[model samples]
Target: MMQRRTLAAGVAAFSALWLAAPLATAAVETPDALVKRLSADILETIKADPELRNGNIARISQVVDNTVMPHVNFRRMTSAAVGPQWRQATPAQRERLQQEFKLMLIRTYAGALKQVSDQRVVVKPLRAAPEDKDVLVRTEVHGKGEPVQLDFRLENTDGKGWKIYNLNVLGVWMVETYRTQFAQELNKGGIDGLINALASRTIAADAKTAKSAQP
Candidate 1:
């Protein structure tokens, strides 16, 4: 299993990438175009904004929650990451899980967003038919190091358009990696155990932020 810190870093990089990809409602907007637009725009925005590149966690997370969450199917992501335990979760339990998981991810990635530099995202070709409800949009983040592969699996929900549910970073699916971690907790305790683990992580992350902001 991937270590929690490694997974957190990888997912944070993904969060920065996807924050660039809000859904475009234009009639001519294809997944490719949408990604292209967001990637370029987000890069430009970051390049011009010192706050985002300077480790401002509150502003970074605000940008993510306000601009990126709308294009994400986080409920689907949280449920899928929980695997079969999702079906067994009570509605309230599921909500708490999603809330805690979202908090953990956003905060973890908030610091990572400062690492965004001259990296450029290149969207790969789309292989899906026009009528396809689901699609995989591949891309690579090229910077100083070898290009890191970052891809998104998006589903065209009824009226929501294309919303991301999964991400592949360096060939590892985000949800799958978390699924293994979550499964371990589930096996040791149960759904509540898993939820508690997520909650604890979020709280710890918040505490770290609180400490950093202290004198």
Candidate 2:
């Protein structure tokens, strides 16, 4: 269980790097090219920014809200993570769930903003044809440790271009991993319970951040 959590954390840390990208690019680059460009741009930005490297939550949160959240398909991610209960959720409940899930990821991003270092991403050649709506961009993160396999699942929107909805790190799919963990909580206390549980986690993380900022 600890190993699983550790892997998940590592995934979150890397995911934060991509989430730091600018909301949109002027050119509609291929998915592989997009990932490669953002990986280098975001890492270099973090490396140069002292505040971001120091884990300044406000700064990190700003980057996430402006850059990360816009590119991510949060509603889809939240619905996938909640599994079957997602369809059952009322519109208000669905919105609440999305907010809570986004909050959790933003907090995770704050903790992980500093994790980007000399890591380099190498995107494998994309195999999809032009008409394909769904595609996978595969890559490996090579740096201070053994290379970690990272892959992204992006769906092309009608006009918005490719939007990231799922990511895999070291073979674990982010949504599936969360779904399994969320299922346990849902079975015990339902959607509200799950929301409350996520809220509690965000609250705890906030306290930890506040304490760390002290002298």
Candidate 3:
């Protein structure tokens, strides 16, 4: 369990790097190119900004908002994570879950980003066809010993460009992992119960943050 959590944390940390790459010159592209562009951009920003190297929460939040969220399809991710429950959810419940799930990820990822230090990413080229709308960009994150494989799955949008819908770390899909946990919670507590649980967790995290800020 600890190993799984660590892998997930690593994925969250790499997510910011996964979004900063430049797309291919071809009119049609693959996931590998997108991941490369996103990761490069993220590294560039951190390299240029010495303060962000410290992993301050505020700075991490800024990077997430500016460089991460814009390219992530949270709604789609949420739906996929929820699995079958997603189809059963009413529109309102779906919306609430989507919002809560996005917040949960942002908060979770923000916390993980604070743990990122001087880590270098090694991009491994993968074969992707032009017609492949959904592709996973595979890379190994090196530093602090034992490189871990990170994969970002992206889908091309009609006009908004490429957006990330899933991430795989060490052969585990982050959203899917959470979905299983969430589904168990829902089964036991129902949709409202799940929402309340997520809210409580967020509130608790916030309180912990506030307490840590004290002198």
Candidate 4:
């Protein structure tokens, strides 16, 4: 049962990777195009680097920093996910939470990337108005098993071009999941409490990684 659960987690992680692949191919012509282009670049690096295939946490972080962070709208996502608490937080607190949340996601997703193997993603055709500020790029992840839908929500920015704010895996929105969790945390301990919790979680995860690496 334990092994089965682990395998299930692995599959879920790979599904995310499968979903992210098409974002690389997104052309600058459209938001969807830019998403595809970015996703493709990240996945291409994963495919090219045999060391990254082993799923090292550090390697995954490097990939995210280099290819993914540049195109993500962390501030917008943090504010939206935290909802009203975002306004309550001091500028410093909000910045801290945003930074921690971003790192948490990168670390979490990086861990998942290790599980992806023998899977490929297919980007569905998208049509949206050029004037539209927000658009969803729909794609599918295919493996030896059934295909699952992955949707990426992107917003156009004057300074940064297209930036991703949300991702849907199998019809589940990642931002919504975080929102619910953050609300619960805030209710239990307030905004500072929630920030501390996220910071602690990151520390614990990093410690675990370090311990595992010790000879």
Cα lDDT listed for each candidate: 0.77, 0.77, 0.68, 0.68
State in Å the error of residue 118, model 2: 0.9
The deviation in Å at residue 195 for candidate 1 is 1.7
- Show how many residue pairs clash in every candidate, following the order shown: 0, 0, 7, 15
Q: Tell me the TM-score of each prediction against the true structure.
A: 0.85, 0.88, 0.80, 0.80
Q: Model 3: residues >4 Å from true position, as ranges? A: 1-9, 18-29, 47-66, 157-160
lDDT of 3 by residue, 19-109 (tens): 3534345554455666666665676666676556544556656656665666688789888887777787889998888767755665665
Tens-place lDDT per residue, model 2, 1-215, is 64544454455346545556764568777888877877877778878987887777677767777787666677888999999998888898888888888778777766565666677778899999988888999988766556678888988877567778998888889899999989998999898888888898889988998988889
Q: Give the range where candidate 3 is weakest over 10 consecutive residues by summed lDDT.
A: 18-27
The count of residue-pair clashes in candidate 1 stands at 0
lDDT leaderboard ranking: 2, 1, 3, 4
Off by over 4 Å in 4: 1-27, 211-215
C-alpha RMSD (angstroms) for model 2: 3.0
Q: Which ten-residue region of model 2 has the weakest summed lDDT?
A: 4-13
Across residues 93-193, which tens digit of lDDT does each residue of candidate 1 receive? 99999888887777766776666666777889999999888889998776655666778888886844677899897788989989999999999989999
Q: Model 3: number of clashes?
A: 7
Error of 3 at 53 (Å): 5.5
Candidate 4 Cα deviation (angstroms), residue 18? 12
